[model samples]
Target: MNQPWSGRKLHFVGIGGIGMSGLAKVARSLGAEVTGSDRAQGGHDARNVPAGATVVFSTAIGADNPERTTGAPELHRADLLAELTQLKPTIAVSGTHGKTTTTSMLVHAMPGESYLVGGEVRSTGTNADWHEDSAWLIVEADESDRSLLKLHPTIAVVTNAELDHHTTYASSRDVDDTFAQFLARARDAVVAPDLTRLRADAHVFGEYDGPLAVPGAHNRKNAAAALTAIEIAQGTAELARELLATFEGAGRRFEVVGTANGATVVDDYAHHPTEVRATIEAARSQHPPRVIALFQPHLFSRTQREARAFGEALAGADMAVLLDVYPARERQEDYPGVSGLLVAEHAYDARPGMPVIWAKTHATARAYLQRALQEGDLLLTMGAGDVNAIGRDLVAHSEPPGR
Candidate 1:
């Protein structure tokens, strides 16, 4: 009962991604045949690919990964669509940001057998599996490049609508238009607080007015949306509050490491502006001695696009340390002259009274904090990349010299 997958063949395109990898794990746990493909030099194989199941992959496969070619399955992302067409699933999860977290929550909360495909593995389960008699099919619906349109789910959840992926959309309106299409695909759609602006005849969730177990008002809304989706899809909310209350939360999303030398070090995988604001606001609610943040930007285009907003969000912290941008699969020139310094500069403008933010290498950022930190300070390392190491290293280094 704890594991939902019970032996179905599941194949994932972009299997190495956080959301995709999580779905693979949920599927494999149900005893389904799980397989996956990833771009060349995909990182984190141990986390992404399931232990047992045939894995056929190629970064070069493109959209051609799913077609059966002379008895061999095509190794492309689109080829998986053909495969999905052949195997009609029960449920799918799709969204830009909160898909992984929400899908993981649903997998953890829902009872009975289910099949799931998402971008990351949330719980301690196999990376991918197959299930024959799943009550539902769970997936992370991504709107980037209209990839989510490929899925037709009984229920769809849009975490929130934000101005992201400037590389594709000319404006935020374009992003909204795409999401409206995604909402149209599902018989019912569940959306969070901010994303309510999207034009969808979809079902609404997360509007329940109750004190939430998760920190931040945003998470409360996320819980509500999730509960609503479950109700519409499964015919009962079924321990929704209890499940949300018990969820310790996925890794690296507000994960608190041990306190050392009177300083508390926390880490989160918040890269976008809204997420940054929400996370900082949550930390502020803790009534800590002081909040000190060390942030690593995720991508060049993202940084350049949201530099001003990023500044406004981070200024909420009492103190700030900005690190170099973490450019995943991008060239440095893609964002020339854009770095963590810009964020610090922008933050300085927003919070003039707060100490001017500092920019440092990961090592130097740690060293600066080690020298300046005081008792009762909250040190947060925020990013979607290796910046998490700063929090770990900071905690290790921040420890009282002897202990």
Candidate 2:
């Protein structure tokens, strides 16, 4: 378990992003020099970006203010399409939801350190690490516009197939077809536990005899895929199950902040339909008292695609709080078609147990929760964006039971 790669150079396109930054950190740990450019800079951009890696600014930088970037990497972002076209490296991870978490898991679990593009590496306390002369270059392959198909990973792991990036794919089948193409590029494709056919030509990795510690059944599938990928990468499945069982899971992936006033506050980054369903089901598996779900929809397009699904998922909670959509990278103009209120209305009709409540902002949502939630309730603030902040604030302000 000596550090795999101990010296090299790596660069990232969107280093400020959580997934991107996590990759940078892992690369640095492998002993590679790291540098990155952010469209806009934030606290995540300017602070603790490894010791030697330079921060470049990109032209995609918007007016968001907090994450401002210098103009250094402006040309780089402008010409990234051409630049990445030429910069060849080793190993790239391609997928949507589990890109960061699973990439990080593979980086930590697998042998032969790698240079990750947008994966979390714990050794360097950052994302996008650089290792020396390593055969592995782990990257999160985004399926937007079939971009991931460009990558050539010796071993590829597909966590799950879902309809994402509506701005790109026309339909769910298109997304799957694109993924099928990506799988075609890999020498060996690591598919989920239940997938039987898996595009025929590619080799599918099998599950070992072991139980994963990760909460949800979805994670169990993720674990199986990761294990398969590791087996392909390192040419050994030895101790893989042991490593998987010890995994505590990534940050904000159903992370429990603390308990308060006889209630438990759990935070998770579950924005998509499949993710939301898995997270809530995991909460229910624990059989917690009165599950209180505080959900903030992530994107306008996503909300529209899965609003009905979202409603059905939230209905599982004993009490649910629905906040306005968090439009992080998208614009408000796109959201009028798919509002959080619409999602709530649909979910209300579907579930007969606890009613889904709507709030315009976090303040109103938190206020509603403060009044409604009592002892023995599990308040789960779940989303991919900033929704976890509400759960943190709630835990901070609430008093212990009988205090």
Candidate 3:
């Protein structure tokens, strides 16, 4: 009775990442010698990766990273995830949208299970948990890196598919084809209505009208998908539905921070145009007097390619504030003339009379919001970057429970 990774030594290159840290923790739980280093976590040799320890790296890790100099064998993060998935009955959730939320929902609705989500779960306050005796495992399968293909799960759920990774697949059809392959390899699958045809044995979940603490039509769809997978796993959905009734949601997915300058500050990890639009619409659904979207563009490539689309999405909000492109791994020098202002201008054009402001920096954005917010208004901050910090700063003076 040995774990698959028992006695193996693994070093993660960017261990500070949410996903990488989760994998490292899980590997350690399963009996691996796990060491990791993040440049931001102070420059140490990842607590010293021993000789011949296999180095595990993600797509974001570069070739020149010091960890790769160990001269040891290398493993992709997906391969490690595949190893973990094979250890138990896995319920994998993948999609262009709703993957994190849906994966979190499954973890919440099912008890006595070990799970890992790409984003931290609000209830658990961590991205992963390891239970030595659990009968099941829940994973947030990532389609962004095309790594979902590496997993072979007992049950798979694809909330929906669309082309958001500009650097990965060439077109939406390529996205679909990849999803179809992921689903085909699963023992059973629940997919979006449009994707049921991708896998002959795939299932389309029934419409969910159940009560949920999370808002949005898209989340309702996500709930339906999670419920369907739970039924497939346990042979019934009633209990799962009961558990989901009070689900609080994962971090940064419509998380309301606190009252800041009379406006309620909400933070979300909605980078894609579709997600942005959905988050805005979901906020509006709660009957807030107004939904002001303060969005920071994540990447230069994505912002350049989808500026207009993002603008259109922001049009769904009552007012829009734009911050400069975050650049992430992409350099601004590589893509000239692409900035958040481009999207702000496009947003203004999309809605002839709507107001749009390009704050250009977080400081300017925060100052403007402080002067502009009003009671009954919801200040929603959306992005994949460190934009949530601004929302937190806005509500810094507020007491606990909301901050």
Model 3, position 60, has a per-residue lDDT of: 86
Better of 2 and 3 by TM-score: 3
Per-residue lDDT over 1-403 for candidate 2, one digit per residue giving the tens place of the 0 to 100 score? 5554446445565777665465456545545577765656533344433444333333334534232342222232323322332333434455667665676666656545644434234434555554455666666666655767666666666776777778788887887788778777777776654443456655554444476666776666566667777667767767776677776666677777887667888888788777777788988888887888889888888888788899888887877788888886688785666778877886787786567788868899877776676787888888877888877787788876766
* TM-score ranking, best first: 3, 1, 2
Which of the predicted structures, 1 or 3, would earn the higher lDDT when compared with the native?
3
Candidate 1 TM-score, C-alpha based: 0.80
Off by over 4 Å in 2: 1-15, 20-91, 115-125, 133-135, 193-198, 205-209
Q: Write the per-residue lDDT of candidate 3 for residues 1-403, one digit (tens) a residue.
A: 6876788898888889999999999989888998888878875363356786899999988767777766779999999899889888999999999999999998889877999899888877889988989989999999998999999799988888889998999999999999999998889989988887778778897557989999999989999999999888889988898889888899889998988867899899999999999999899988988899999999999999999999999999989999999988899899999999999999999998898988989999988887787777899999999899889998985443333
Taking every candidate in turn, the Cα RMSD to the unseen true structure, in Å, is 5.4, 5.4, 2.3
Candidate 2 vs candidate 3: the lDDT winner is 3
**lDDT of the structure predicted as candidate 3:** 0.89
Shift in Å, residue 121, candidate 1: 6.9
Please give the distance, in angstroms, between residue 64's alpha carbon in candidate 1 and its true position after superposition: 15
lDDT-based ranking:
3, 1, 2
Error of 3 at 343 (Å): 0.4
